[model samples]
Target: MTASRPAVEIFANPRADRSAPRPGVLTHEARAEAQAAIRAWPGYAPTPLLDLPGLARRLGVAAVRWKDEGGRFGLGSFKALGGAYAVQRLVREHGGDVTFAAATDGNHGRSVAWGAKQAGARAVIYLHAGVSPGREAALRALGAEIVRVAGNYDDSVRQCARAAAERGWQVVSDTAWEGYREVPTAVMAGYSLIAAEAVAQMGAERPTHVLVQGGVGGVAAAICAELREAWGADAPRFVVVEPALAACLLESARRGGRTEIPIAEETVMAGLSCGDPSPLAWEILDTGADDFAAVDDAWVPPAMRLLADGESGDPRVVAGESGVAGLALLLAARERSETWAALGLDAGSRVLLIGTEGATDPEIYREIVGRGADEVAGTVAR
Candidate 1:
């Protein structure tokens, strides 16, 4: 029997201080530097911004724009903009043969490995027990040595930190802690490119609401910071989404501070199964995000299928499990009139959802969507 869906937990941030200054780490100058650097690299085309008229009609919204990052730098995830860029920055600062290490459930590791390969450096990636073999293999194919850890993502992160420090390997983590700010700040700066690209693609037409998935809240914070800087008082309402099973950001928002939760169970959204909120990311998200929504894992498969099937005549998108979190949150929220009204979503609302990754794990994608990513992209016969 199919399992039942859980109630969607929504929390409105009481601390969305619009007058607060933007975080120093992700300032416009930092993004400019990152943009110029990243654009100079090979294969740096901006991902497509797709208009989903049919989806908008169905959802009672004026427009729905999807910033599809599946093809980002040919890495199949928006993480391509962050981890790799941070690695490159480190290589420039250190040396060509400098070693970098990171703990990841998937995409970020691939990005670091890819960056290391480009610079002829060494990459050591750590994965928790829950990460799929397909994801581990992807990192290995990118030329990273994989180390399996004992517990959850947070455990792997601790192990990675210890090992990196002992082995003299620079930790190129996407999540920032107390003392480890510079590298993660650089990572988030690179992620600011997503908002930059989206702003350019939209061309003065700004969304009323932007729903972004939160994994340690890095990408969401980056986007929130960038859009707030770009639009100032006219910034779009930011909604941070995550799996209910691992809603560290939401809990942090509710508590009015950075919070960490224990991961008792792993969600199918492997990329978002993080238990700890990044301290640096929290600095921006505390006041930048308007709301935090955690939706059940049961909503993911259907959302993925919806994007793949293009049920509304929209172009097909190969959004992975974690990639579809924002869409899942939207689907859940619309079903409840209270949530829909609370979010100020209506006939005139222009919604922006980022498809954060493609088929990062083809096996899981095929199992969930019943088709391969290439087939959905029309590259292979369906």
Candidate 2:
């Protein structure tokens, strides 16, 4: 018999105050500025918003729309939007000879490196012990000088900040802390583009629920801000999902403030294995987000397979380990009637999910899905 999937941990944020003012970082002006600049870049294009009628039927929902970011800017992840856009802003403000630095599990580093290359600048990426070698190799291929840190993602963030400050290099981090908010603010603005495109692709058909994966909570908060801005009181109910092993966002929601958890073990969902929550992201998510959920690693592989298999005539999607967290949480939650009811999920509900990354690491993708990304995408014959 197969090992049973763990119970999903759900938290209805008690402090969610929708009447509060919008976070300053996510203003309309900032988002528009970032969008215009990013669009002007040579390879900018909107990723597809796929209709998943199969999953909708399985979950008894009216519809399920998936924003597939696997092929975003040919970088294989949605992260191509944020870090690269931030790098462009920095390069324009500063000079072309500057060095940009950041901490990453993989995708963000690649974006920063690619941006640096485009601007004729330098990139220095910091990685923790838990990050995969394939991710490191991908960054190196983009011309980033890799620095291995001792602890988890948060630790790597600290080291990256310190080294960048000491060496006079710019830190283009997605998370924000005291006295450090501008670059991260711009990063979040760039991320809002994903939500903007999704809303446009959706047209007049509005979704009732949005289930988004959270790492440091940057992307989740960005999407929430964007949708809420676009639709106001008519926006979808936002749900943030993270790995159970490193569910700092959930813990923060429970405590009614920013919180950090000790990462004793790393989840296979590498990008979501972040122990600390971003303060900038939390400001928006604290009020904008309706729910937070933690899903176990056991659900990841199956979610990836389900997308790859395209059950019930759904289109095949190349979702990576981290990319499937939102879907994994949905699958786990629907198994429990109480949890399902509490989330307000019903047959009439229209839900949206974000597939944040593709096969960022091909070896791991093959091991989990039993096929290459191209094969799952029908680009190669099986």
Query: Across residues 300-327, which tens digit of lDDT does each residue of candidate 2 receive?
Result: 9989999998979999988999999988
TM-score each candidate. Answer: 0.97, 0.97
List lDDT for all candidates, in order: 0.90, 0.90
Mind giving the per-residue lDDT tens digits that candidate 1 earns over 183-299?
Answer: 998999999999999999999899999999998989999999889888987899999999988999999988878899999989999999999999889989999899999999988
**Candidate 1 at residue 179, lDDT?**
88
lDDT of 1 at 153: 97
Full-model lDDT, candidate 1: 0.90
Cα-based RMSD of candidate 1: 1.8
Which lDDT value does model 2 have at 54? 94
